[model samples]
Target: MSAETNKALVRRFFEEVLNGRNLEVIDELVATDYQEHDPFPGQREGREGLKDRMTMLIEGLAPTFTIDDLIAEGDRVVIRWTNNATHSGTFLGIPPTGRSCRFAGIDIFRMDDDRLAEHWHVVDQLSMLQQLELLPSS
Candidate 1:
């Protein structure tokens, strides 16, 4: 696929899959053997694991996610995103605080055969925790 197509696929992931809360699209957009370099706690492996992780996130945060930027080059797409949501469900052993939080992250995805094959991401967890009042801000 062309670089533009790859970028579009990534966009659809954030728009239709994440923000839209449509998990069905994962099977079509992700490879069967997808890999996540930064797996969440208790997160399994492969595309199924990816689906599980997303499910947990959606249920826990009920986030309104937004993609701030997207860049694609040679079968890779990088996305900068922000999410705003209330902590209504447990996440990473932290019980619900019912507080609103905003966090940003950057993800790099590798495309294989027109599907997402691998992913690596960095999220502002510390800031999120602080926003939740789980940690003191500096």
Candidate 2:
């Protein structure tokens, strides 16, 4: 796909799937036998399965987080921003602290035939833990 086309695909994915909270978009953006290589949760198959996992992630930190600085290159997009939210739910075995926290990260996605084929992403998990009081605030 052209760079602009790829960028549009990503924009739709983020806008409709992620930000819009529309799981159905996954089917349109992913293959039926999509392969997910998310290290945080092992592996999953099918677009619906991926949507389920994403739903968990979003619901776990909803109304407090949004994707920012989403830029695309070729078939990949690099997102740079902070996930700021109040810890009102459990995460990674950490209880709610009601503490607001911010952590920045970059996610690179690879597209295949206009659909999201794979992803390689990294986030500031340590900073999030610290903000949640699970780790030293220093």
Q: List the residue pairs that clash in candidate 1.
A: none
For lDDT, the strongest prediction is 1
> CA lDDT of each candidate?
0.92, 0.71
Query: After aligning candidate 1 to the native by TM-score, how far in Å is the CA of 7 from where it should be?
Result: 0.8
- Candidate 2's error at 81, in angstroms? 2.9
Candidate 2 achieves a global lDDT of: 0.71
For TM-score, the strongest prediction is 1
Per-residue lDDT of candidate 1, residues 104-123 (tens digit): 99999999999999999999
Where is model 1 more than 4 Å wrong at Cα?
Answer: none
TM-score of each model, paired residue for residue = 0.97, 0.80
**Poorest 10 consecutive residues of model 1 by lDDT?**
85-94
